[model samples]
Structures are given as structure tokens and as C-alpha cells.
Target: MSTIILVIGYAISCTKNDQVIIPDAGASSTTLVSVNTSTPPTIDGSIDALWNSATKISITPTVPDPGNGLFTGYIGEQYAGTLRSMYDAQNIYFLLEVTDASQSTNVTPWYFDPTANVAGKTGWAKEPSSKTYDVNGNLIRAAWGEDKFAMLWNIDNSTPKFAAQTCYASCHVFTPYLDYSGVLASPQTATTPPTVSNSGSGNHYTNGPNEKIDMWWGRLGYITKDASLNLMDDNYQDYAGGQAITNLTGGNANGRHVDGIVPDGTKSTIWPYRPNYTVSPTQGEVGNTQNLKLDGTGASVAVPLWVIPNAGSANFILVSDTTSGKAKKVTAVSSAGVLTLSDGSTINPTVGTDYQRTGDAVNGPTAKNSIPANIAVPLIGGRADITCAATYTGTGWIIEYKRALKTGDVLKQDIDFSSLQDQVFGVAFWNKSNNQHGIQPNLTLTFKK
Candidate 1:
């Protein structure tokens, strides 16, 4: 905290060097909010009147690090946030909003196949670790990333002083750490030492085994909409809790690290996963949403994005499928996405024009920013405990989280709200795309009966 001060002389037109002084930064505050029983608001990521009635708590930095050689992702101030929370008899809901400059939607996704230099077929990249050098091998680890928000709750009051210390209770500053990059390869000895590639010291687990910290990890883009897929990674920080493991018997929900897709390498056989993420409904291209339609013959053409099942649902007709030679009506059901029948059956469209209306022209659907339900990419985790519905409203992101107040199975690592006491929770943010996250801690939410 340095400051430059200008010195003044009375008569001699003073010739003196400017003095420098340093001052301490202003104090930071903790956020605390109380909640009353209320109806569950629609989990649409919009600021509705329901949330307006609840107490608002600002989530800012507690302790941040300049990061250990992992590029220049400093913490303590960048991606600050505010949140509102309330619970009903059945479910607990959270609405978190953040101020982010940009979004990183590309996880390990299928890009131009380097081998074939083609689109669509080439396997996806395992991680977004592309680096550029100045013709010198100087490592330019520029950060490019997707937006993510996480909340770690110390359930059962097991963690000592977690609420006061927040995530710092476990986030240790281990020395001689290495960053996780897709391109970099550390030499492996005959013993295969524990490298930063396998285990990192900076962001490693800080909790104890089986102690249980409920981690509600939410992600945006990579295939889904702003903040759709919300999964709870059941975690208890263990110095030995490694993210990279071969047998993912418990799945990624246990914080196991699965390999990302790489060209001409071992591929994953997980179904419904688009390379690295769980498939999601909103992962479709937002520009052109496609629906289902029948031609005069038995064939189908890519029409428009499906309408959800409801009174407002859409119905399209094609005379080719009807014996009356009249346009038969196809009604949209509750299930949306993909050009498909109301019954959720496949109605294949003509190859070229039907496959997203052939390249450049937006000749497909009526909605400008819509995604066909069927074709949209999805999250790899399927559905998670904490589910969200979020969309970027031009400025920042408005996300909604919904989960059962009590998951009943505490053994499965669910956050137990059955007792309804003030529990310790910490939050983190990732801003400006890439892996750079903002570290903040200790926002308490107390619920009243």
C-alpha cells in the first residue's frame, strides 16, 4: 500500500524529492443473512419477487493468493458475488449472482481435428492448455476458461472452526507446486514420483477423509447454457484425495479426475457425455433451434425447436403422413429439444439442409436464441444433487439452485439441513474465462422455522 505525497515549500520554491508513504487497506466484512419459510421460487435464474423478500448476503474475498506460478490469477477481489437463500418444507433454494467480464464455455471439446483437419469427427482435446511462445520456449500460460461457482458446506459441524475460517481451514499453501496443463509433460522416474500432473499442492484437498464437506459445484457453457448443470461433488479434503485416478468406480461425483479427450489417444466410452461433460438439455446451439416435421411423404424435415409440453406447446402438421392428404398435426410435449415427434420419437430429417440448415443461412427456426432439445450437447455428470437454471441476461449471470433440504443419505455425502442450524460454508468464483478462480470465504445462512 504505497502512496506518493507532494511536498510544498513556503518561499524558496522548494526543491525536494517527493516522499513515499504506505497505508493499510480498509477492512473487509463478513456476510450473514437469516431466512424464513417461503415458497420455492421458479428456478429460472431470474430475479423474481420471491428472492427480493429474503436477506441478501454479499460474497467477497477473505484470503486470496497470487497463485503459485500458475499464471497470474490473483484472488481476494476480482469476482465478488451476492446471494439470497430460503427454504421450504421440501427443498432449499439459492440464487447467486456474480459480476463477470466474459465466459469460458469451452471445456475439452471437439475442435478442428489436427490429424484430419476436419470438423465433427476428430476427438476432443482433453484440456484447454494451449500455450503460445515468442519463438522462444518461454512458457506463456495464458488463462482461458469456463465460468464456475462452488460452495463448500461443512456439514454435521464436524470441521472445527470452519465457519470462522471458511475454506482457509483446509486450503493449505503447499510449496513447490506445479500447475495442471494439458500440453506440459513432467518427466516420470522409474518410481513415478507424485508430480503436479497427478497431484497439485496449491489447490489440493484440505479436509479429512470421511469428515464430509458438501461441495455444490456448478458450471456454465461447455455445451450447456449459462448455469444449468449443478452437481454436488461429495468431498472431504484429504491430502491423499487425488483428482486423477484410473478406476472411477464412484464416478466424478467423488472428485475423481477423469482424462480429457486427446487426438489419437485412449478414448473414453462413457455414454451421453460429450467428451468431458455431462449431456445437458440446453447444450444445443442457441442461434438456430430445430423442431420436427413430416414431409408430404413419410420423410421428415428439420422444422423448428420443439415446444415444451404444455398448453403453450406447438403443433406442426405435414400432409405427407396423413391419409386424408391434409397436414397432420404434431404436438410438442413436455419434453423439448431436437426435431422430434410429440411422443419423443425420432423423425430423422434430410441430411444436408436438415442438419442445422446447412452452414451459413439461418433458414431453420423462428426463435432467434433457441436450442433444439435433441441436438444440444449435455453435461457428462447427468443430473446432480444441486440443479440450477441460469441464463446470461446480457450483463452478468443469474443462476438458481434447487435441492432437497435433506438428502436423507448422509453416508452418501449429502449436506444435511435436517437440523437447521448455522453451518459453515465457503464460496469461490472463476472470472474472465479460463481456470482463474476468485477465492472468498465464510458466508453464513441461518434458516428460521
Candidate 2:
């Protein structure tokens, strides 16, 4: 039978029933107390009044050694942040503030290319790199990647090494030649791809079965506060065995998986305006007929699916403009097969140039701040348990979120805090790149008596 999970508002209470949730583990040394609150803070990005008196925890993340010769290539500035927690009878709320020089919103976004055809999408371009790498082949910064934060909670003490290793417990690095499990009879290289059956280089899998960790992932560029969905991808990690690769694509295998069924079944079909992203034909106003335009020679050529109308003040749309619904997107085409903007202006094709939003001027027609690569959609099912909001203040980011104290998920996808027992968890921050991140492990969480 399908379980019914209630969606509670910021003012409503979703307390734990009379059920007792007993964990199979013990406590740690350092503790971050979750103080009691008669008045809970709102989950908006703004700092609320009740947060002034709550206990806070310092979070300073640093790059971790993955143990192999493989390097994260991250040479970006390291910054520290603060974490605050509070709880009432029904829900637990969190406030996270971190320092960052730049607000990276875009990942890999599509652009209008006049002379290229990728995967049958003719005249389209996508940024491959930020070109900000150092001489040592280390990634100096993520000029094109988004800013992100994540937390992993130990589930029922299933992972014994969690308090000590934290994120490392679920992470395994593979060499270019050797496999951890010795499952493959032969060695593999960068050219030879590694599958679950074979191992070469990659990580993020649990050591054994039944070892589960609940993950709360927040992407600054992907934060959505709409009713259809919110930000924060509710994911989890379990055993996929040693030598298994991290699952970038959605699924239950390869360790990391979303909270609901396989393939992100609860993911929203529509996209929100906040955390603005490049629109596509399927999800936005662009249509299939607008894919191509007639050139001066009367030959059909490819065109962009979307563009910012009257892009005068800025080369690209800003996050603030999207939130206010001022970022105009024009998808209508002219009778002569030319692209038209909302202001009735036509986009003339320019060879050897592309309309792109990126950090690199060489790869962009008009360089500006980055645009979001993904749209914000609410996650349904078990994945929709958490509600969140985030804001970037030019210098850093402020994120606020909340979840029910107890969510009776039959799939064991969540940890129950009704018992108020101390639990161990690990938090991480990703400045730009994906693999390179700072992790603070073995953090003990306890409720104030």
C-alpha cells in the first residue's frame, strides 16, 4: 500500500505520533545542539528573529584526499560558514550562511551556434570548461559551475565508519589500471570505460549492503520555492559494492539515488521562474518549428531555442530578474524564418559566433554572468519531504530549509528524529566543481532538554 505523507506549512506542526524510533547506534564526541523553539523560523531565505538566540555551529570545509593519485584539481579559495538549528514539536529548521566571492549559477548551458551540429542538434553550442585550470592540472575554480552544499546523516548506525570517515566511507577511488574488487580480469585505462562489472577510476559507493546514508543536496542555481516543488534534491546512498562508480544519471544503482522510486519518479514536469535556467522546446515557450531559420541564401540553418529579449543592460538574465518575472524570453519566429525577440527585434545569424552565457569571453558572444543550466522543479513522493529557500547576496549565500521531525517513510529513506537521540552527520560545500568539496564529518546532533 502507498503511504500518505503530509505537506506541512511553516506555521503548521507535523510532530511525530506516539511511535518510538530506536536507532541501532551510539553518540559521538562533539555536539551541535538543536535548541527548543516555541516559535519556529520561517523557511524563507531571510534570517528570522528567532534565529538570534539559537545555538550555532561553525562549518569550515576543506578538500579531502581521495587516497589515489587522482586529484580534484580545485585551487579555489576556501571559505568558512556557520550552521544554526532549531526545532519545535513538529519540525526542524536550519540556517546556513557561507562566504563566496562569486555567485556561479550556470553549469553547462546550450548556446546558439551558427556552424556546429552536436548529436543532431545543429547550430547549437555548449560550454565544456571554464578554462580556469592551473598548470598542475588542478581545477583552480569553477568559473562555469554552480555553488552548492550538502549534508549526509547516518541511518540507524548502519555505517559503522560514518563517525570517523563520514563522506569517505561511501567514497572509493579507482586507479587507472587496478580494480578494487579484482572483478575484472584485465586492467583498464582512461580510454577503456569502466562499468559496474569492471572498475577503473571513479567513486561514491558504500562498502557493504544495508549501509544507508540520507543526503540533502542544495544547489544555489537550482533552488525553487514554488508550490509545485521546492529546491534541495533529497538523495541517499547505500551499498553498490567496491569499485562501483558514482551514479550521475538517476537510478538506485551505483550508490547515490533519489528518495522516491528509480529514475526520479517524483521529479516535477514543469519548471519555475526562480533560479532561472535556459529554456528548451519541451519545457518552455519554444516550439519545434522554431528550431531552424532561412539563411540569406534561402537555405535553412539552425537557430537558438530561447534568448533574452532586449538584452541591453546585461548580456544574460540575472537571478533577481527571474524572481521578479522581468526576464523576458522571446521564442516567436518571423515569417521569413528569422528569430524574433519579445520587443519585435530580429536575431540576425552571425557566423563564427554564438550567443552564450558563460564566464569565458572567448566562448561567448557577449560575456556576462553565467545562466542556470537546469530549471527548478518540485520533487514529489518521498523526495518532496523537505522545503527550502535560498538567496545569493553578491558576496555569499544564505540558505534556509526545514523538514518534519518524523516522516514515516516505509522505504527507510529518512532518519527519524522523534526519539531526540544524538545522531552523527557530515556536511560538505562545493564551491564550483562536482568532485572537489570540503567535508566536515562526525558532527553530533542532539536536542536540548
Candidate 3:
């Protein structure tokens, strides 16, 4: 039976005894905190077990009717199979099994005749020898020669694997060799041939390198490429059309010269091919602002933190004298991109300078100046590190301040503050301490509203 996991959100109110207390208010109770209970899924299994339970598919080679001396050995027939599995964590595993029972006896090798001056032929082309099958006898090769094979996967499917009415090995369209081998009397005996290395050498596999192949291999659970190409790791010119062999020969044959080995004790020659890529998160970055409503239900009071642009602003504010107590009211005039006070005094809004807002009298006849709400009192050159005290409750922030009154009273102003780009103002009652008692007084502060 399959197990289905259900996740539920529950709020818990715990007392000093470590026991959960469910309030009578149900889920609407703000005194409780909700918690989610769910674990991420994963996959666990051995490589062999994974391979056996995966989906398996076969790829084979096709035989030409008018036997081209090209695929001669045992009629150039072979098949390969691949197995794929997906783990619980969505990780994908691929195991390729190749079978070439004919082995060396069924090998047919050919090279492109560079001097042949064929219009489009530029590299080595191999044509396998013909094969004759007896009614009740084993397959026999009418001729014998060296053989090489390469398998291609449609990892990206950018290009057609095989052209119509043509075996992939017939047209010599996809050459995995870097340097076309010139016609020679005998084939090279070295295990490593002089042909360009498809896996490296920066030649045949120009589009898909080993590094790209590995990345796609790991990300298979989350992504998939269109097509893949498998070429013989060795330098032999035996190319196969894979599972689409019939597509290449106009329905003449159903498969190509590919083999599938279950990858036992031997290392498989197949390599995944893919293009270079960069991974980016689908959700992107987080934003800095939240919505606020005026219905008294949204975040009303919030600490204002201004990010100053430069050091000049910082120095200007740092040198300002906050203890002066005396306030100044001056008119700010801007012209020709320059700012100056009405007193004919010019102040540079650079770092280390203190800016004061000026306006009409604030409270009584004794006050000659007051900070105006329309005036900007900016501390210039302050770095972007400006920070103010704020209370964050997941959804909002609150800013707090105190108010002073002439009645020798002090009170707190709890205004729903928004952004620093605008002015703010509020009123509250202040409490004063008398010689032997405390008194309350009406108080108000008028600055940048």
C-alpha cells in the first residue's frame, strides 16, 4: 500500500510545564504560534538495483539493400540498450548496456578518401563489409576488416540525427574525427588513434564538452535536453543511427549499428553530451517594501532608516552640533543647481555637515524658530548604514519617540509611521513630575511632518 503524507498547520500555546495549551478562540487566537510538520523526500538504493528497475530501450543499426562495401563485416549489424531510473529525491541515474556479440569478427572499418575530392566529403568514412546469413546457419562475414563504432544521443536535439534515405554512416555528414585520415595501406594498431578525440581535443565535440555533459547528467531530475550523440570512444569510423535506424533507410531496416551492454565489470564507452549553461533561481531576489493601510489595521509606526549616498553626507552630519538647543529658521533657495540659505550663507550637503529645517514659530512667543514639515533636515554624506530602532512583527515595523512639554512633562507619541520620503507629525499628552506629585500636560511636536 502506498503511504500518503498529509501536512497540517497547528498553533501551540505552551505553559511553563511544556504542555501545549489550545485557546478557546481557536485558529483566530493571536496568542498562539503555528508550526508546520513535514519532511522532505529522498531516494536510497544501490547502483545495481537502480539499473534493474529502470526503463530500458534498445538501439540498433540498419543493413543497406545493395550492400555498400562500407558496412561489410557481418552486414554491419549491432544493437545497444539504455536503462534509466529516478530516485525519491528526483535524482536520475542512467545505465547503458552494449552488446556486439560479433566482436572483432563483425568489424568493418572505412576511412574518407581525402583525395577522392568528393564535393562534401572532407573526413574519413568507414564502410563495413557485406554479410551472408544461412537459413539454418550462423551469420558469416563475406569479407573481413577493422571496425569502429560511435553512438549519438539526442541530448539537445538541435540537429537531425540521420538524413532521409541515408544511413548516418553512409553520408559522412557527422564526422567525429578531428583530422581526416589520408588513405593508407594498413590501419593504425595503436589503441589511441590519431583522429581528433571527440570527448576532448576541442574538435568534434565542440558544442558539448565533458563538463557540460556531467552537469546535465546530475540535473536530469529537474531538466532534460532534447538529444544526445554517442560516438565510438575509439578512433574507428563506425557510426550508428541509434534507435532511429528505420528513419534513416526509408523503412528499409528498423535499427542501426548500436549496442547496449548492461555495464558489468567493464567500463562503458558511452558519454553524455550537453551544452554549457548557467542555472538561475526561478523566484529571483526579495523586495524591500511592504504595503500599509490607513484603516488603523496596518503597520502605523516604523523606524526610519535612510541610506545616505556617500562619505560627504556622513561627514556633514557627524560634525553637526545637536546640543545647540537653539533652533534656526532659514529660507532655502535653489537656483542654477546650487542651494543657499536666505541669510546669504551657502551650505554644502556633503558628508560631515548638519542640516536644520527652518520655519515659523513652533509653540509660544518665546520661540522664534521651529523645524518645518516642508523643510528637509538632512545629515549629508551619511553612509548607507543608517539604522533606526524598530519593532518587527513579521508583517510590519514600528518607530517610537518621546514628546516634551513646558509643563515639565514627558510623553510618548505612537504614530503609525510610513516612509522617510514624506513628513510625519503627531500629538500626545506629557506627564510632568512636580515637587511631590506627577502632573499631565498637553504636548505637541512640529518638525518635518
Candidate 4:
């Protein structure tokens, strides 16, 4: 809800007929209402007065002119279009008038369509009657209309400028009121200085005497100064000997340009320019996996699950834990449906022995010493002990054990081994404590060479 007020550069008329009007000089006759809340009371006169006063201060002459030729060139370049200043404020209404005689000859009143976009398209463009020239032949741009006007203050300068092409007017408006304290000022003058109300104490225009117009022009790679308002040489140069006039035309058109109204009422573009101030919300990386802490209740947080590369083939695998945390490898599955792991090893589960038996249970050779020379049991028996001992592990479980066979030995058992050959297999672990507890550990098994 805080307000920001920016002092955009002023448009000085070349001709006296183009003079800007100040509000009638008298104590406000109507009851002044606070603009802080929704559905603020109507006080048109006070709003207009405050707006005019703020505009006057923004246009007040700060530094001496840089001679007529340079000033004219600056205006000519600025006429092409240049962003002057940007600020935010509360309920105070602000207007920017661009008198383009070439574009409009009659009373060209500035009007703005404050409506936002719909379906990703601007509603203003659809409103046929949104733009019109006023009776004075000046291009008038107003911010809000009716109840929607309240949303105007909520707008940051960039959105309005970028979305609705508000930059076409070349003038920016700031509202509420800003304190000019600590801002450099011209010496006390015969003409009464403009009075500024300190309503929004912290709010001030981004560009001010402390931040000279020259500094902005330099940033924009172009220079600008008023030629008609020059003081003596003593007043023209700063103590550092740097001329007050700024050169914005850095001699490059590398940056995009926007249009602005010149003092001569001409439409011109300001090239390679940047705004005096900007505000941006915090943003996060696209593929960040860090846990995002949420603030306040009912707030939702989103994290990216996976990324699909634009090229190559797409396949789904269990999310990798190793490479995800450190150096992990996404097991590559070959076109033959073989799962290849980083280390070379082939896994093919046995059918009758490796798999669980469903039918009648096999009574063990009751005693290891009283075993028959050769034992015979149904292939589909409920369960058979493949190894003499219940459990023994080296690389994999010993399904059928032999005392003389060494590790890595390929020993074939004659009990229907064909049913298990070439069958793909996967390993799964269960937490013995809980039947429901199971986990797929970081294991990648590949077929042997």
C-alpha cells in the first residue's frame, strides 16, 4: 500500500500559447478526503490541484541550458522518444500531455484506457474509442477511469509502460507527494518556488536534482539540456567542472527506443534508454531442487519434478538419488529393453527356484547327512531350498549350493533352468520390521557382456 512518486522530466512549450495551467490559487473549498482506502470520496478539484503542482515541480528548471544548438539537438533526439522518469503514489491522479501538432491539429486531449489485458491481449486495443485527440490538439493520456482508477496507484511503472505502450506518450507520472529535502535546489529566486507537500514521506521521484537529468541522459546514451534557460557560465558548470548538460547519445542504437514529445510539440523517439528506477519481485531458478520454505498459512509452494531435454529419446526411470545428490547416473535402457548399469553385471532371475512357489510345500531332505544320492521333487512344488544352507550371499543369493564350486563359477542345475533363462529381473528390498515398508535403493543392474 506504500506510494511512490516519481518526477519524470517536464515538457516545456516552445511557444507561450502552450503554457501549462496551474490550479486556481485559493484554499481548497471542498472537504478533503483521504485517498488511502477503497472507494475514496470524490474530491476532483483537490486532486487536480495536487497533480498540477507536482508536474510544475518536476518541470522546474534545475540546471542552466547547454546553449541553443545542443538543446535543440537534445529535444530533436528526445522527440523520437525517451523515457523521462517513473514513480508510484497513492490516490493522486496524474496526467501526461503530448502535444503533437503533426499527429493532431485540433484540440488533442490526452486520454488513457486503464483497462488491463484479457486472454493475454490488451483490452485497451479492443476499446475502439479509447484514444482520441482533444480540442487543444494535444495528445492527452489519463491513467484511470471510474472505480478502476484505484488500481492505477497499484501499478508499477514498468507494467503500464511495457504492456499498454504508455511509453508512446514519452512522459511518466508519479503521485501522492514526495519530500524534496536533501535534493539540490536552485538558489532562492525572485519567482516564488513551488510548494511540495510531504504527504508520502518516503516516496520521491527516482530522478531529481541529486540525480541530475544529465545522469539519466548519459545512461540512455543521449544528451539533453534546455538551451532557452541558460544562466551565466558560473551557474552552468558543477564544482567538479563537469558540464551540467548530459550527453545521452552514446553513439549506439544497440538498445530499443521509445517515443516522447519534444518541446516543439513534435513526436520523436528516444533511443537506447533505461528507466530512472525499477522495482522487481524476487524470482527463483528454473531447475532448483532446494526446499522452498513457505510463509503464512494457505501459501502454496511448487518445485520442479523433472526436466525433459529437447533432443534425444525420452524414457522414464525411477528418480535417481545418487546423481541427484552427488554424481549420479541415469541408467540407460537399450532399444532391446536391457537395463544397463554403470558397473557391468547381468541380472536374470531363475524361474522355478528364484521365483516363489505357489503349490504344495517341499519337505526338505529331512537331514543333510541322510540325503538320497539324487532327490526328486515336483518342479511346481510350493518351495524348495536351492542352497543347502538357508542363506549364503556373495554377489547374489546362492539358489543351488555345492561345496566344491568357487565364487563366480557358472554351475548349471538340471531342474527346468530353461524357464528362467533370458528373463529380465529387478531387485527390491523390504523392511523386515514392517511388511508395508519397502524402498528402491540407488541400484542399477546391467546385463553381463
**Candidate 4 local lDDT, 1-449, one digit each (tens):** 00111111122111111111221212121112112222322221112233322211111111112122112211211111001111122222222221111211011111112232122221111111112235774433211110000000101122222122111111111122222333423223214443444221111111222211100100000000111111101000001111111112211111111111111322223322222212122211112122221221222222112222111111111123224542122133222212223444321112122111222222111111110111111111111111111111211111111111111212111111111112111111111110110111111111111
Over the stretch 19-124, how does candidate 3's per-residue lDDT look in tens digits?
1111121111111111111221121211334234334432222222122122223222223222232222211122323233322211122212224323322222
C-alpha RMSD (angstroms) for model 1:
15.3
Residue 382's lDDT within candidate 4 is: 11
- Decreasing TM-score order of the candidates: 2, 1, 3, 4
Give the Å shift of residue 164 in candidate 4: 33
Ranking the candidates on lDDT from highest down gives 2, 1, 3, 4
Model 4 error, position 100 (Å) = 30
Model 4 root mean square deviation, Cα atoms = 38.5
Instruction: lDDT winner between 2 and 4, please give it.
Output: 2
Question: Per-prediction TM-score, please?
Answer: 0.53, 0.66, 0.19, 0.16
TM value for model 4: 0.16
| Clash count in backbone of candidate 4 | 37
Error of 2 at 83 (Å): 0.5
- Model 1 stretches with alpha carbons more than 4 Å out: 1-29, 61-63, 71-77, 108-110, 113-143, 172-203, 222-383, 410-412, 432-434
Q: Would you give me the overall lDDT of model 4?
A: 0.17
Question: For this target, which candidate reaches the highest lDDT against the unseen true structure?
Answer: 2
Count clashes in each candidate, considering only residues at least 3 apart in sequence or on different chains.
Answer: 30, 3, 73, 37
lDDT of each: 0.41, 0.53, 0.19, 0.17
For model 1, residues 199-287, the per-residue Cα lDDT tens digits are 12234332554443455555555214323333322233322343232112221212221112112323245411112332234322232
